[model samples]
Target: MTLSENGDLWCDIRTLHPAGNHPALFLDRDGTLIELVDYLSDPAAVVLIGSVLEDIWQANKDGHAVVIVTNQSGIGRGYYRWADFHAVQARLYDLLAAEDLVIDATYACPHPPPDAGGPAHSLYRKPAPGMLTRAADDLNLDLSRSRILGDSVSDLAAGKAAGLPVGILVSDGYGARDAEAARVLADDGFEVIRR
Candidate 1:
């Protein structure tokens, strides 16, 4: 993982293969690509969900940039440090490399909600488009043709706010308990994938 001068943590897949102005697959980290663990701070706990690797591989093959946008409020809540997050991310990168899957970039928001007292809710957090917009600019991604995939409503909402065309909700992680809400999002044009 490389930290760009702009402060984005990225894998820089362009070095391995060139892709220009492609649509992106914006993904939520926890509960989307990996099993959800509350305040997960251990690198050893990184576990990829069965379908995510294949799906990400397919997206890569199809020339789509895969970028992870996650909300890590645990940091703001003092449950974990930034170093812990980096350790977990490094482990995740190693695991994905073993599968021949590469993520183009990762953006995270560490701010907590107003009620949590970390700070005012950040625009970079889910349900907001700041992170996606920054990724699009930095990566030269086409937002209109992009899609977001994850296990929570906020992920879909972020995609929508970013002006992306589609959002897919996978029925795993937090999504399992949000079936009804998922259906509601589907009615609003989001895709709900039962896994």
Candidate 2:
């Protein structure tokens, strides 16, 4: 794929080779799929907000692979261990399974900001598109046909930088400040704002 002068990454969707022209649905885990909490490590704290299950199920029915891309800075901040995060994720998977919503895969970044002295502003974090790029490579996803639903502008920015066809923002879970920033992005057509 050739890069545009604006530095937007481009790809040929027909070459990706998914059957029947299906698209992959990329979702942000914490806020888009479940209610955001303060570094939730407990398995019981996982809760599906609103119609997430139905939405995912619909995507599946529409012939899309449902994947989760997330950033878990709590691990780098020492607020929760990776093992605890996995336990919580396992419970979350079980809960989603009970609702008949199957997530194809989950990708995450555990690093924090460079100022925090964690991982030095790693590329895997949101707004960098590292995780999304890795997911596309591993899954052979067609970025031009895929969609990203996130709760912050950073998430939308990541989607944009990665060349996703659609970016959706969930208004809840994010704080007031981020929501306002998302509004600006939505107004600019950088993403579709959904509440």
Candidate 3:
């Protein structure tokens, strides 16, 4: 999937092979699937966390659609361009392809916070259900059986708002820092996976 010149998401719908209303594994890009690099734009900086790849591959083997739903505020913040994000995505796709793994779809929200002149509390950002709901609609996914994995509380919040069955916070990157806060999510039925 690629973002169009007008910043619209252009997914190759033909490539999506959902397994009959199967659940989706929504994932965050940085800190969750890859190394945490602030505003990463260079393809050379891309590094896959081995466990994430294994989990995604296993989910695919188990008949779950794997989709990457990320919040790319860097584009809105002027830290990087949309093309740069695509370049990194291209590298990521190549890497995953080499491993015989395919992500069903990818969605990114370039909008930043209202204080930064971006859309005010945009629904596309984390803690909102826009991206998840959009993907669910586009892919015919079963939200009631779906799960979301990330390293931040907002990721779980987004999944919760989207009515997904589960939200997992991996204990890597920002997870360690937010361990205490994650307890609240755990109380709310979120799972914390410690590395």
- lDDT winner: 3
Give the whole-model CA lDDT for all candidates, comma-separated. Answer: 0.79, 0.71, 0.80
Candidate 2: count the clashes: 0
lDDT for predicted candidate 2 compared with the true structure: 0.71
Clashing pairs in 1: none
TM-score of 1: 0.86
Model 1 — which ten-residue stretch has the worst lDDT? 8-17
TM-score each candidate: 0.86, 0.82, 0.89
- Assess candidate 1 and give its lDDT: 0.79
**Model 2, C-alpha of 168: deviation from truth (Å):** 1.2
Rank by TM-score, highest first.
3, 1, 2
Q: Encode model 3's per-residue lDDT on 1-195: one tens digit a residue.
A: 556465634343324663578788999889988899999999999898887888788887987888888888898889999788889988988888889888888888887767777777586788788889888888889988888888988888888888886788887769888767756766445454445
Better of 1 and 3 by TM-score: 3
Question: What's the C-alpha lDDT at position 179 in model 2?
Answer: 70
List where candidate 2 sits over 4 angstroms from the true fold: 1-22, 186-190
* Cα lDDT tens digits for candidate 2, 1-195: 222243222221222335443467888877778898878888898888765667788887876777787877787788987678778878988888788777776776776767776565567778888867876776677787888888787887788788875777776677344776765655343556566
